[model samples]
Target: MKGIPMRINVLQHTPNEGPGMIQDWSDKNGYEMFIYHPYQFGYLPTADETDMLVILGGPMSPNDDLPWIKQERELIQELLNQDKPIFGVCYGAQQIVKTMGYQVTKSPAKEVGFAPVYRRDVKFLNIPEELNVLHWHEEMFEVPEQAQLLFSSDKVENQGFILNHRVVGLQFHLEPKEDNVREIVVNDFPYIKGSVLNQTSEEILQTKISDDNKQTLYKLLDYIIEK
Candidate 1:
């Protein structure tokens, strides 16, 4: 008999900020995708029903006192309690750090476009030691206790981290598609300032993520599954 397909539950905080390349990856990788937009109307899946958990980026901070925020953190905590495989992006990554009892602070400069990062140290995701990836957040989390620091950029000390080699948190936008970028830029361009680390709208739109980064993201997903 054929085995059951793996189920990937995507917890999205915003409607526009949907899973980009992640949705494509799941369709091609034989994983069933279920998205929960608590902001609109939905309930988070039970831990037993979810094979993988993906927390997408949002505009709100993890520290926000919204009801959904608390519920989502509770769900993430439960998932972590079981050592579930998880991939968090931007605000999602910050949520992981905050859930682990750490501070996610506002960086000195907002990273509003492509930025370079040194793949400091990680055993799970095999990526180039150095590469420029997509970015669009201002807050950075301190390295959480018992979590391996995976990557870092000049503007943020904590770009990525891994807990128990299963729960991965990434502050960058490794899975953003063209539409996703356009949407965020259109809706939230006011946040982009003229800081040295900030990129202009034109520059951000012009910078096409190369196939190398796409491949690495896929490999990262595969690593999560195979783990």
Candidate 2:
């Protein structure tokens, strides 16, 4: 391990979506965190200076023809070049998949509320057999050949993956606080269009997130940082 007080840089695509447990964990662990909103501003920190990279969820797809999207991928490539640990959530995970030359497309069955992701195999990650996590995306990606599949959901087979053992990507949100959920529900109301795999906004509100997801998130953070 490098040491205490790691420099973690977060790439936020929107003001509505902020790093929830990520920021909380970083603060508790005393890791210096810096957030960059490419949508609100235009600048990327050098990869070398950052010990880890965190990509937060957003409304836009990774394949969108936006300048910031391209720039985000470029920075991700540079971070990969530096062999830095990276944690991506939802759209952030899609960005990592796309940067790895994989394709992300509209899901046949999208998840708009809480869903269960079952563990495929006991490899590096110490995840549960099945864990319910927050879901709010209609797009999913193919697992890259170089990545190890970690979890699989009914709607999306590729629920979680790890690249180079240090980089982790999750299609679901383990880091969501209750307020985060409320904010997303309010902002992404359009996505909750009541698909077969999706739940109604009221249904989502009635559901309570399990504690195991947040606990596992802490374990995963430790795993990446320790590696």
Q: Give the winner by lDDT.
A: 2
lDDT of 2 by residue, 1-227 (tens): 76767899998887777888888899899889999988778887777778999998888999889998888898899888878889999899999999989999998787888878898875556667899888878888788998888889887898889877678899889998888888888887787786555578887877788878778888888887775
Cα deviation of 84, candidate 2, in Å = 0.4
Q: Which residue pairs come into collision in candidate 1?
A: none
In candidate 2, stretches whose alpha carbon ends up further than 4 angstroms from where it belongs are: 1-4
Q: Please write out the lDDT profile of model 1 over residues 16-132, one tens digit for every residue.
A: 688989999999977899998876785788888988999988889987888888788888888889888889999988888888889988887688888888887564466788778
| lDDT of model 2, residue 29 | 91
Model 2, residue 185: displacement in angstroms? Answer: 0.9
For model 2, what is the C-alpha lDDT against the true structure? 0.85
TM-score of 2: 0.93
Query: Any residue pairs clashing in model 2, and if so which?
Result: none
Q: Which stretches of candidate 1 lie over 4 Å from their true place?
A: 123-125
**What is each predicted model's overall lDDT from 0 to 1?**
0.82, 0.85
**How high is each candidate's TM-score?**
0.93, 0.93
